[model samples]
Target: PDECPLAACVNILAPCRSVYRWQGKVENTTEIPLLIKTTRACYAALAARLLQLHPYEVPEIIAVPLVAGLPAYLTWVATEVLSSP
Candidate 1:
């Protein structure tokens, strides 16, 4: 996806299946999730870009907060993304 602020990201097949009702039937499917290491300053624009270009009417985009991590790893993540808001 364009406009992503991360210098690198991890994409993997999600472990759990997504279940929902569609047209009076239950639909279950697997999804590939992308874990992007980006700065908080870039999240809004990044999310907007994904929504604009996404094929689905509704895409599942979730941002998990990083409460704690190795200082070096966190620093690496911060450096990979833009510093300016």
Candidate 2:
């Protein structure tokens, strides 16, 4: 968590509730899901890093493309993920 910039984006962990089927039964769970608001260019790298650092063998590394968002907010995401340059 400390190694990921998204975890620090707002200085707070995003709260989430997840539901899925497992072992032939539906289950629900609550988790501190971190929504890493990063650019397309950063998705792959961030995902790879998460896989390496995450304890789960198959971490829930899903990337939902930003089709539309407030322009200012999208710009902020881009800036937040920009590598030192």
Candidate 3:
């Protein structure tokens, strides 16, 4: 939570019910997944923060690069995250 605070970006908290096999056993769990919408620039910082605070030995930190987006929306995302030159 401290890693990616609400103030860090426009975050969406999603409840995820997951079922998977681990240690030769089927497991089911409900997890709170955070959908964080921030700029590419913030990715590294955010990931580092997550590593520092995440309880899991290996946290699930995955980033899908934005290949296509609405022009206006893309511009807004860039504007929101770009550092001042």
Q: What TM-score does each of the candidates earn?
A: 0.72, 0.63, 0.64
Residues 8-42, model 2: lDDT tens digits: 26333766788987779987887677666677777
Best by lDDT: 1
Superposed Cα RMSD, model 1: 2.8
Candidate 1, run of 10 with poorest lDDT: 1-10
Best by TM-score: 1
Question: What's the best-to-worst order under lDDT?
Answer: 1, 2, 3
Tens digits of per-residue lDDT, candidate 3, 27-79, equal 79887787666566677776777788788777788887778889888777666
Q: Candidate 1 vs candidate 3: which has greater TM-score?
A: 1
Q: Backbone clashes in each candidate structure, one number apiece?
A: 0, 0, 0
- The list of candidate 1 runs beyond 4 A from truth reads 1-4, 14-16
lDDT-wise, the better of 1 and 3 is: 1
Better of 1 and 2 by TM-score: 1
For 1-85, candidate 1 gives per-residue lDDT tens digits of 2364543355665677779887799989876666766667777766777788778788887788888889998888777776665
lDDT agreement with native, every candidate: 0.71, 0.70, 0.67
Ranking by TM-score: 1, 3, 2
Query: What overall lDDT, based on C-alpha atoms, would model 3 receive against the true structure?
Result: 0.67
